[model samples]
Target: MTSPNAAQVPTIKSALKFFKVTSYITGIFLILIMVLWAIRLIWSADVWIGGPDGLIALAQFSVDPSTGEKVGLPGPQIPNDFTTVSLIIHGWLYVAYLFGDFRLWTLLRWSFLRFLVIALGGVIPFLSFFTERYYSKVAEADLKKVA
Candidate 1:
């Protein structure tokens, strides 16, 4: 039979791995959402369809009589499907990331303020990458002491 202490060790190690993986995944999702949102914002300005009237301007296509080549309009607005999907996925990823942060923080018995800082990593761009590295190192060292 495994001792209580030995059982706890594996649980703690597994928790740490969970935190590490989720942090990376959350960070990636946040970056993707930010990029997609920016593109959507920029593209919105060029959209031909606008106003309550609807279909402000139909997509203009013309045939070049000289060459008989059909030419498409420039800056045709595309749908925001990518942006919408990224936003939704990132929201869910942030929730998972928070769960990971909570588990590690409580296990380590870190301060509540520290927990807040770790949580912010998901919302702030580029913060998750740095925070994950720092948190992992500190948690590992603390776990070594406990083990």
Candidate 2:
């Protein structure tokens, strides 16, 4: 509160808006990543690029024709980059979320621990949304005090 930059109300408000948007987008992507992780666990984690049924998730095993028995290995298919693409996209989005977080944290001159907690919001499912709401209220109150 005693920081020299504390008087920069407009900058803080803009930072708050940026942080809010990043939190929401990162939260949604986090949920999507969680969903993809679950899907991988339930079926096969591997996705194929160019098989007879291109761009598909392979099962854990294949069936034997002659013996009419289940085989332990999966059928061959070209590995697709689609599975990892979403993960990469999320990673980059989280970085953007971090940038917004850092900007807000710097403007408010908050503690390092608080900054870390806010950073965690992007990784934990639904936590970003909660943190966004909580901080929006806190920032609004703080801005009012400054006014």
What TM-score would you give candidate 1 relative to the actual structure?
Answer: 0.69
- Output the number of the lDDT-best candidate: 2
Residue-wise lDDT of candidate 1 within 9-119, one digit each (tens)? 677678889888888898998888776566445543222344233554333445678997435544323442344456678899899899988987766678899899999
lDDT of each: 0.71, 0.75
The Cα RMSD in angstroms, rounded to one decimal, for candidate 1 relative to the true structure is 11.2
The total of clashing pairs for model 1 equals 0
lDDT for residue 139 in candidate 2, whole number 0-100: 75
After superposition, candidate 1 runs with Cα above 4 Å error: 1-7, 45-80
User: Which portions of model 2 miss their true places by more than 4 Å?
Assistant: 1-7, 45-79
Provide backbone clash counts, one per model.
0, 0
* Candidate 1 lDDT trough over 10 residues, lowest sum: 44-53
